[model samples]
Target: MWDDVFPIDQVQEIRTKTTVYLGAGAIKKIYDIAKDLKEKGVDNVLVVTGRSSYKKTGAWDHVEKALKEQGMGYAVYDKVTPNPTADSVDEATKMGKDLGANAVIAIGGGSPIDAAKSVAILLEYKDKTARDLYELSFVPQRAVPLVAINLTHGTGTEVDRFAVVSIPEKEYKPAIAYDCIYPMYSIDDPELMTGLSLDQTKYVSIDALNHVIEACTTKTANPFSILLAKETVRLIAKYLPKAVENPQDLRARYFLLYASMIAGVSFDNGLLHFTHALEHPLSAIKPELAHGLGLAMIVPAVVEAIYPASKDILDEVLEPITKGAEGAEEVAKTLEKWIFSVGVTSKLEDEGFKGEDIPKLVKLVRETPSLDGLVSLAPVEGTDEVIKKIYQRSLKPIA
Candidate 1:
């Protein structure tokens, strides 16, 4: 079955700066990774994670056991919330500093891993604050070593060099990409993902879908990004529903996890544009909103707007979901129907956003740091008016 989508002959190791340990029981490598880190003078480490998933996913047991066996001191900062904020990053940084941590171990999905990346930066640059990082006030040159034990099949933070954090007071949810933040060692173990809820399974896969959609259509897109983007879409279209139906399906989880990893690498090489640029503000304002849900709400409108400029590439990359749908409007509608079929039926309005919020959302997008950079990569110009129209179209259910 896997050969039909991603051929066996094409399977090859991805050589990146980060060393990835994949497959079932990959978490066991943590013991050796921990020993190696300790040899490099990493006497103490900061463990960043959300409150419950660390133990629920059965990652904490392996991570904790590894640290103990290596005699490595570690501290846990488990208060990372969804849509992690600068405040949380600041708090975690303080904990890492106080613990004299020389390394960071991120043990959750994107939220904790991203937060850990920020914390790692702050730990290295002791004088810099989370505000400085998110605001782009400082260009980070280096960070302490990071080990990511990814428990979710989405975000791909374990392998990517991007970190997003919200500064709610400024209503900014900006992303930072730096070579310094890529995890030195990462684990993608599908066995740790069986505990994900149905909503998590659906939402994370949607996030991967959005990643490739924007990556392939962006101005910097190359043949490499297009190749991975199509495969990412195919894997998600085939496996997401299976994982959603039976959360314990390891095969589905494995493929979905693989889809997300490549999606991360795709965007890392090709970058992203409108959908991610616009969705950050929505989650920034409503901190409770899931990032994937916000992307799902905004992506159809983005596809409709950008399809004219990137018709050929968009049509090819989105083939799995578009299913022969031609033209911009029809392709957008087909994509919307696929999102709905995956149980993400809510519109922006249902998620407590209204048409009146468009101006604020647009303002946040324009004023937020790093966002305009993302918008500029859009195939079509993402003007203020264009941005507003996308938000307006997403306010209600698809007609």
Candidate 2:
């Protein structure tokens, strides 16, 4: 039945590697997980996080309290930054290895979880640095177990096998995917996300939305992936605004987190396209600019450029994004309006993406491994000319 709609190679392989505990108070389940890990003879754990967001929200305290109660030894590696560097992964992996960690507890958003995933593989590699891992010169013998406690609603790193790491000196951000990097379990505790600033909420919400949007239109999208994508788009369309307007609304926060996870699962089977491919260099070069903003600036132009070739799914997505809007042009405009309504201004120039930077940005995207293949998965060819045009369009606000 599945193969009927999707070709054999394009068929999605479904697997539920992570046991997810979700909802308002789900963070408390960490205690139960710690107890189980202890019972299973897992001793040392590495608590990976970024600068003080977990500490600010007291989520780290909850994780620590649970580990302490279970008498589990652990180490902290919290130096991860947004668009986390490969060097940081190597540094954290060393700490985890030195602590003899049997497992990693990834707390916070995508950066930390992504770092944890890289660290998991690197901890087992023993002799290789993150540079070697990024270069694909070494594969891990085994991944250290991971428990993902998600504090934000983006990236879906908790449920996916992908990790995107940056090399700052070379101005490159490359993604890595290996099956073993999938977390053993995950927690989507909305309570942990209530502390997110309005911009953080808005940015990651759009990030998740892009995850579904891009995957849904990718060449590999299957029936199941599109179903998940449609629902994810609808949920984000309805809930993101409410969550952003009122951060204290746990219901909105919970559903948005749900959307993020579903999109993660959807895209795990169906890959992404030029939206992510284009956004990579933006964030890689300007690490301070949130990734979702880059997507917002670039997606309208990308959608318009690809619409002629991608119309089947692109037209089908209109009802979800715009309530039965007709035509790809209308969908792109509606998407642009919706993005603007979210308080995300869509000008790459505003983010310091200049004409001079275009060449280097395109160079970085080409230099990044596997991205060209992913970009080629788009209906439109992501040739140097096309990518340059997309970046040039992004410099102005998407109309």
Candidate 3:
């Protein structure tokens, strides 16, 4: 087993660029937030979001009303897809530039908010392409100020500078991590999540759960991350089932949203391992598959594969996740069972991937230059062949 390979000589500190406001109707704080930005000379703003849901959920109306009341000029870029692409970021940047947007406000889930982050940065880099952003060839000194009013409890994109942007043509999705892309602030109102379907709540909650599990299990796990991960795991294990069973449970939704932010901070600091690396290619190839479901499908397989190396840490975290389950294998089984109970049961085969797709996914993992950093963080050796075998294991039904 590889010992924790991170720099132990350097002390790890917890920090965040985004300040969070949380409550039942916390989204209403956007009105004052917009006014403050306007006072600070952010006159024209870009509102990045998805279609129909924002309107259907009344979030867009709320934001529109705020902008109108504040007399702030705003343009809406609402074409953000589930797995947002570099092309979409470029298009949104073009719109923000055309509208002379000096600030960005994002509503909806991770995709739109993440797109907003890239768009804000790209607005300043008129000469650079989204491809340059994805390739890390250029780093903007700053992004236009961003404010996120989260509509989903998942992604936690509102609180972090990282954005997962897809190069769909190449069948790759890599995170765009830069210092300046963090939001100026975030408003996480559990009320917004009330309209979510049970499936939506379950899948997104699972994504947050994975963030905690991945961060706690990574080589960089420290005092801060360990605390956050344990608390996040316990909260999700207790509240996610309740949220999934009763989508209108305000208590459940609130805690799940809290856990999402906690897990986001944990992973943002500790970084993730093979779970994200393995899950990325699946979604990149099948854009229709929900990101959380893709993570759900392969998480147990990767955990089981890495058990030999991660057992001690897995044992420590297993009780919080399993309540009483012990040992690495039992923890994995319990995790998978909990995932099944929560309603995500799709396998790679069920998602339309065949035996041939395994090699394709393996190749994508092997070829993704940026993935090497994340791949190297896995507790177990993640050789191309080992990654290929994990993908093979995922071909069977998860249940």
Candidate with the greatest TM-score versus the true structure = 1
Q: Give the alpha-carbon lDDT of every model.
A: 0.90, 0.83, 0.81
Which is the leading candidate under lDDT? 1
Ranking by lDDT: 1, 2, 3
Each prediction's Cα RMSD?
2.1, 5.8, 6.5
Candidate order by decreasing TM-score: 1, 2, 3
Residue-wise C-alpha lDDT for candidate 3, range 127-179, written one tens digit per residue:
98788888778768888999888888878777776888899889988877788
Clashing pairs in 1: none
Model 3: lowest-lDDT 10 consecutive positions: 1-10
- 64-110 per-residue lDDT for model 2 (tens digits): 99999989899999899988898899899889888999889999899
**Native-vs-model 1 lDDT?**
0.90
Give the worst 10-residue stretch by lDDT in candidate 2.
Answer: 3-12
Mark the regions of model 3 whose C-alpha exceeds 4 Å error after superposition: 1-15, 323-327
Q: Per-prediction TM-score, please?
A: 0.97, 0.93, 0.93
Query: Candidate 1: minimum summed lDDT over ten consecutive residues — where?
Result: 3-12
| Clashing residue pairs in candidate 2 (N, C-alpha, C atoms within 3 angstroms) | none
